[model samples]
Target: MKSNIKYKKTKLSTTTKIALYKTMLKPRLIEEKMLILLRQGKISKWFSGIGQEAISVGVTMAMQAEEYILPMHRNLGVFTTREIPLYRLFSQWQGKANGFTKGRDRSFHFGTQEFNIVGMISHLGPQFGVADGIALASKLKNKNQVTAVFTGEGGTSEGDIHEALNVASVWQLPVLFCIENNGYGLSTPTKEQYNCENLADRALGYGMESHIIDGNNILEVYTKISEITESIRKKPRPVLIEFKTFRMRGHEEASGTKYVPQDLMDQWAEKDPIENYRLHLLTEGVLTEKEDAIFKAEIKAEIDTHLDKTNAEEVIVSTESNELNDVYKDFEYQNIEESSNTNELRLIDAIHEGLKQSMEKHDDLVIMGQDIAEYGGVFKITDGFVEAFGKDRVRNTPICESAIIETAMGLSIAGIKSIVELQFSDFVTSGFNPVVNYLAKSHYRWNQNADVVLRMPCGAGVAAGPFHSQTNEAWFTKTPGLKVVYPAFPKDAKGLLATAINDPNPVLFFEHKALYRSIRQEVPTDYFTIPFGKAATLKQGTDITIIAYGQAVHWALNTLEKHKDISADVIDLRSLQPLDTETIYASTKKTGRVIILQEDSLFGGIASDISALIMENCFESLDAPVKRVASLETPIPFINHLEDQYLARDKFEDELLALLAY
Candidate 1:
């Protein structure tokens, strides 16, 4: 460990030095009390940062209040340095109503915009990508703010950390990546985790400036961080700082420290950051023993007051009415007049029109995806977007789905609405962690709306096979906060996209590859939006009802037109989540028979849920058993002949005839 042996009097003022001392001391005292609570069985878990106070406090003290800080669970000094209320911290651990998450999340897993601190998720690596996004937001808005994110040496091994560093470097965003290299990742030593000698060497791979320093030296940590932050403010850059420290305790209170060698723990105890810094101040005459005693006494009294107050508070009880509240933003739909003048547009062109319209309306809106900037996307959906919106608003991301999704969450949390396009819908599975765990639950957990629109080009009709083709609407529809929208025609595509971009919740917008260029319609030139959960009745009849979305909707229309005798009501459910149950029941009651169709597989598909809903709500009105037509339960084959056989379109005619006969 390299140490700055001498601390200059001019480098840090007396006030700032004392403030850093107090900042480091608060977390040490707070965690000491928390460990006592853990032993008494009052607290469930305790993650101590006893030996890492210098790194967390030093890095955080350099950041401005407007800049963001995403902290790991063990970085208690970060909260203390940022001046977060001690009572609120106590309330959060006790699950009281006054907590950051209103008793929704336990411990340090809550973020508040007021403080510019994003709470850590249990999965720590994803927050690295999120910090990049928050930095991106600050850059796009010309805020000139720097974001600081902390993780341990264990986190550097995660793919998300690599993706985030690559993105921040490529984009030249202002982000400080701090690695608390605590010598162990829950008993796994540094040698077992990486092949390199120093973890900071990994930053060179991403074209970032790297530094290695003695983390136990408080003055050294603060001096280096302040200098890095000052340089980053002038010219945005991504920097990596590796603090070679040691974890003096177990991973958590429940996880015993037996795996750690007793000799190593004894060695680190002699170099305790707080005690070392305290002795240095005393030796240098910067502080007297009496002043040190006063500072310690003040911190202890403050913690005791908040602890008592938080313990006396009542726990929050969730009611049925508010339990589902904030899952989706429910605002009154405003009906806009459609233009008499119209333009003939293909489905792809209509989607482009929606994007242009949205960007023109909202200055804070941004579009991010792989190959979207210069290449204009694989399908040309975002062609000329960079020229129109500039590269700042229109971004080209690396082929990292997880980082792309997690970055969008960070931007959304920072109050910037974003639209992200997955080149292929099948790749959504790669980005499923943030979408399901973070994005889907943001609103419910903390009333945090990641107003992000995810555009997925889906379905199998283009002969693209399994890797590029998939309709995964069923996956998001089951998620509470996600709104799933699948449009069939060009006009519907344009209108629904406009609505989705303006929505205050996460929306999964599915665009069928087959329909992109094949489908054309006369769409209104003026801006228009179709309300979610309202089914459009295409062709009405009393004999049978065909309910479908995306490419299946067109298949139903084609089948009905071919057989004029089989008069049927074709209902297009534009949005799957807000199911349009009223229109569905009305159409099924009039027709007395129904057939639900989908391009996805049969079992556990969206059609299954619709069938169950029909049975529960309108079972008595059905004259015959409801039928479902969907693709075979297997991966889509590459051969065109096999693909054609696997699709539901070929089988739709027979299923419709069977339903008519019934």
Candidate 2:
């Protein structure tokens, strides 16, 4: 239904109208050809944006070129509006060697920093969170830039969307949240999605300005967006603009229209943005019919030419040499190869030192977490950072875990290295999608290095219980393209964090909460880095090998001290991703016995992997079967007695003696 306000004539000049017509027509024709390609099996899939061209064109024209746009698969018009090279678009669709992702990704799952467009996956919610990061980065830099995020009405139901909106609102970031309410999300109609009569009204809850526009009306879309864009540039506040439009086609070329009514489709077709805008231009004397026809023909010819050229380009064949060519950036330790100074520091202070030192080294470093600013984190790991680095670098984010990690990913994409802190390690599950799907695979898929360090204060013994205490290193260790580092000592904590921040891949730095105050060491004043995949042999022995990490290392050390007669060599597997299996095997072969220890649950923990590695490599050298000691497979109890009983140190010691005797 049209708005009650009287329809006003567009004040756009003839040249502007002509330009809009040409811009809007480009994506419509491109998408039409894409569907044809899909039918011919030349392209794998087709997500048509047939009726949403005006929104894409209008928003693109309203925002500056430097402002980033995170477009979904259906927003093909965004690429066209941003003037991404026609051949590059066709090449990406054809999955050619010169594509944005070098043919590693097909469809709309690609982005380039050069064009300020973010790569989008099928999941729409997280992209908004990532876009919030881009906007936050721009605001922090004091740049008059804004980021535009495009999502469908159905995506607004996702928790990540709400989280992004809340974060954007609370921070007063400059973000344009453009929701294309295109009637249906895949197949579910708007009736099943939201209870609100107008989606824009939801913005009022966040205390942000809201507007609803007839997306098919190109002139109206352009004028409203231009006004909002100007206002956002000045105030840097998020604005939610729900463009009311409809999808005239099925969800994709493969999907049929059985879910949508023929009448509804017909109604939307009559309100086609391309055709309506062309008629408006004609009526406004922007172009003659002959001129309009020639312009469309020219666009069709251009698309066809690019399509043929992209089709002719060589397809990328996955080769042995290039298989892992760009999975990780090669980094070598340059300075401070060995420890030289003797300055005692608590684990917490060491961590703070590492962050301070890293920030001193890199100007683009940003630390974001809950209560990390003036409050200095729940554990005070980032205390005094806000004062030292300023609020712009040491940001206190809202308690949105998904947005936290996703924002770090976005900031990394925009060339800002980020250190994200999950107040407690247990909360990593809340942000699992971005960490596993986006952060972990970004380097492997697009050769983009997400330079993010996720500081997780993990482990038990402090009686913080299951909700607060968790050793989630195993989850990330199993995930490819992520570096998992768990340091057991203050020295290792400081060194590993410095190394993690420098590493090109995303690193999950697990800091034991119990060890924060319990462990004190004379850490090096000068910076030093311990290479990943290299295990440190803390003590030498001939009886057996005790391989452990995190708090388990301390437990094993105490076990050895209690039974001095049974000499044991302890190996610390600092980095879980590039595990030092060689060190583990050598120690196991020498001692002829292995005991793997971890603070995580026994069912599926890092200890299980360690035991498997010992058996696989040092099976013949073993004098007895490998023993594993881990927390019981149950949620940590809130009571200290139950938690202590769950982690029986005596039982672990008894198992160690049995292995030694065997």
Cα deviation of 9, candidate 1, in Å: 6.2
Candidate 1: regions farther than 4 A off? 1-10, 329-332
Q: Residue by residue across 1-662, what tens digits does model 2's lDDT show? A: 32222225877777777788789889988887877778888888788888888898999888899999998877777788888889998888777877787777878898877778886877778998999888888987889888999999999999999999998998888999999999998899999999989999999899988999999888888888988999899889999999999987788867877889888888778888777666655665666889978988999999888877887888677786676666665667554564676789999889988889999988889999999999988888778888788988888888889988888888887778999999998998999999988898777677777889999998788887779877778888888788899999998888888899988779999999989999999998877777778888999999999888888888888988887887778999888888888898889889998888777878778788888877887799998999988778788887888888877454688888788778
C-alpha-based local distance difference test score of model 2? 0.85
In candidate 2, the residue pairs with backbone N, CA or C atoms under 3 Å apart (3 or more residues apart, or in different chains) clash, namely none
lDDT score, candidate 1, position 168: 90
User: How accurate locally, in lDDT, is each candidate?
Assistant: 0.87, 0.85
lDDT of 1 at 110: 82
Output the lDDT of residue 417, model 1: 89
